[model samples]
Target: MDVIGGKWKALILWELENYGVRRFGELRRGLPGVSEKMLIQQLRELEEDGIVTREVYREVPPRVEYQLTELGTALNRALEPLGDWGRDRIERIGANRVHPVTT
Candidate 1:
């Protein structure tokens, strides 16, 4: 869990896995609630962990994109069952959220 245990890490992985290569801005837009700083931090962490690859293109504006490494893809595959359990959990407990939390 150390590598992909953060709040936004798994979602980031899921997004990249499902959508393929993504630029920083595209990743920000794809994940609706993530702030710019958080996204950058998460991406850097993922890259350092060898779960993501960052490609830099020298151009007029300097284009950069991120994709999963082979290890990352395999990790994502391993997360499939966890994702399924989360979805099932949501369905199972969705009704419990009918009331807003007071705190």
Candidate 2:
């Protein structure tokens, strides 16, 4: 759970899954709220965990892209049902009440 647990990791994975391959700038743009430092940290962790692959291109400006590994693909697939359930629960509770007050 730790490998993919967090606010941004799963979202990052989902984005990669949807887009196939994404560059650093692309991911940064896609996730508007995530800071560059946090994104880099998360990507590094994911790469170290073998859930993501990073490729670099040799060029003047340089280019780097990220993709999900086999393990990452399986993990994302396994979480599909969980994602669906969350969506349903959110709808049932209403988006504005997703985090209701607790006293």
Candidate 3:
């Protein structure tokens, strides 16, 4: 939970799960509004948490790609229902205009 708690972590994992393998630039492009620094930080954290595997290709430009590990895939599955529930809740609340104040 700690690893996937970040704002962009789950989204990143979902992207990887859907896309299979993706380069850093690709991920950055896919997730608009995520700064490069934040993307790097989140990717590093995910890698450290054993949720993502980063592979580097020994090429002239040094190609790199990220993919979800087995653990990450399992986590993704677990979070899917939560995501659906959240979306449904948000839609319901939006329709009702139930805006809770935060302090």
Candidate 4:
């Protein structure tokens, strides 16, 4: 739970799952609220946890991309039920009535 537990990490994983391979700029754009430094930190943690893979390419501008590992896919599958339950709860109780749970 600690691995994927964070305000932005799960969102980052969702973005990666939605988009196959994403560059730093792409991820930054996708998650406008996240600071670049925080994104970098979260991505490094994810990579270290074996949930994400970072690829670097030798190019004029130096390109780097992030993709989900097999473990990440499994993690996402595990999270789907929770996500559904949250959505259902929100639909049933309404967003204002649903209290956000913190770690």
RMSD of each: 3.7, 3.5, 3.8, 5.0
Candidate lDDT (C-alpha), each: 0.94, 0.93, 0.93, 0.92
Arranged by TM-score, best first: 1, 2, 4, 3
lDDT of 1 by residue, 1-103 (tens): 8899778999999999999999999999999999999999999999999999999999979999999999999999999999999999897677658854566
Which scores higher on TM-score, 1 or 4? 1
Q: Any idea what lDDT model 3 has?
A: 0.93
Which pairs clash in the backbone of model 1?
A: none
Query: What would the TM-scores of all predictions be?
Result: 0.89, 0.88, 0.87, 0.87
lDDT of 4 by residue, 17-99 (tens): 99989999999999988999999999999999999999999998999999999999899999999999988977867754576
Per-model clash counts, in order, read 0, 0, 0, 0
Task: Give the Cα error of residue 79 in candidate 1, in Å.
Answer: 0.6
Question: In terms of TM-score, how similar is model 1 to the real structure?
Answer: 0.89
Q: Model 4 off-target regions past 4 Å?
A: 95-103
Worst 10 residues of 1 by lDDT: 94-103
lDDT ranking from best candidate downward = 1, 3, 2, 4
Off by over 4 Å in 2: 95-103
Better candidate number, 2 or 4, judged by TM-score: 2
Cα lDDT tens digits, model 3, 24-57, are: 9999999999999999999999999999999999
